[model samples]
Target: MAMAAARVVVEAEHLLPPGGLAPDAVQTPGPFVDRIVGLGPLGEEYAVVRR
Candidate 1:
């Protein structure tokens, strides 16, 4: 997350959402996919139903 934020700050002076990064800035993908996989079926099965 800090990498994402640094990418934004390098390009813009003001506060920006994590999505505001340039394509090149996001060189490596975040741990999002790995985390989702770790969460497994129970995670997906209940994520929406409970939320």
Candidate 2:
């Protein structure tokens, strides 16, 4: 009962917008990729791994 109510509340709140957590994350792969790419961290990985 408690879990179901919590889920309903979460779903209701998740109807907000793009920056909202659950709604935004529903489709995409989350912001880990964006944060790493934005910070240029992948360059180090590529340089270290490439021959």
Candidate 3:
């Protein structure tokens, strides 16, 4: 199980952008607070929240 999980993570990482997901200067919409926008390697969008 651990190996499988690690493999999945590695595959996912490969799908990420060259430098990995980069935090955008824009903020997420809606009532959520402290969330930032991110872009992936394939131009995929992500809403990331930092603790």
Candidate 4:
């Protein structure tokens, strides 16, 4: 790990609609994540990413 307090930014195609992400669908676990954001080029969603 680079740093314990390190945070990462993630850009995704779409935000979690309403149902949320399924356990199997999620690539990373929630504890490792810091936060989530919504990014827009044409009104898209953004999220926090970590390793």
Candidate 5:
């Protein structure tokens, strides 16, 4: 995955919609992003859903 190879900050609103990223807001799509940095006050990291 390109994101896995480098550092990337994805723009997201929430992570509890129970569905994939917003169709219109999808920048990289799936299969390319191996993970996603969660929203935190002091900058935290978390793994998102995988294919």
Candidate 6:
């Protein structure tokens, strides 16, 4: 559920036109990161190995 929502937000950001806002106008509140750890049958194994 959360992943779906986050993906939507990321996709929407990609739709925004270039230079719509000043580069320094926005800042993340804190450290933030997103990543796709794995997919399909070997996903669990890949995630564990990545950790």
TM-score for each predicted model, relative to the true structure: 0.22, 0.15, 0.16, 0.46, 0.41, 0.22
Q: Any idea how many clashes model 1 has? A: 0
Question: What does candidate 1's lDDT look like per residue over 1-51, in tens digits?
Answer: 645453422222244466776768654465422321222234555666541
What are the per-residue Cα lDDT tens digits for candidate 2 across 1-51? 433342221212223445656564554343322221212234654776542
Pairs of residues clashing in candidate 1: none
The residue ranges of model 6 lying beyond 4 angstroms of the native Cα positions read: 1-16, 29-51
Candidate 3 per-residue C-alpha lDDT over 1-51 given as tens digits, one digit per residue, 9 for 90 to 100: 433342221222234443455557223322333332443454324435322
lDDT of each: 0.43, 0.37, 0.34, 0.60, 0.56, 0.39
Q: By TM-score, how accurate is candidate 4?
A: 0.46
Candidate 2 lowest-lDDT run of ten: 32-41
Candidate 3 positional error at 40, Å: 2.1
Which candidate comes out best when scored by TM-score?
4
> How much is 6 displaced in model 3, in angstroms?
28
Ten residues in sequence with the least summed lDDT for candidate 1: 32-41
Prediction 2 global C-alpha lDDT:
0.37
Candidate closer to the true structure by TM-score (higher is better), 3 or 6? 6
Please give the distance, in angstroms, between residue 25's alpha carbon in candidate 2 and its true position after superposition: 6.4
Candidate 5 or 2, higher lDDT: 5
Tens-digit lDDT track of model 5 for 1-51? 455666545545466554655678666765666566655443334345332
Give candidate 2 regions above 4 Å deviation: 1-14, 22-51
Q: Which residue runs does candidate 1 get wrong by more than 4 Å? A: 1-16, 31-51
Summing lDDT over every window of 10 consecutive residues in candidate 4, give the lowest-scoring window.
42-51
Give the clash count for each candidate. Answer: 0, 0, 0, 3, 0, 0
- Which candidate, 1 or 2, would have the higher TM-score against the true structure? 1
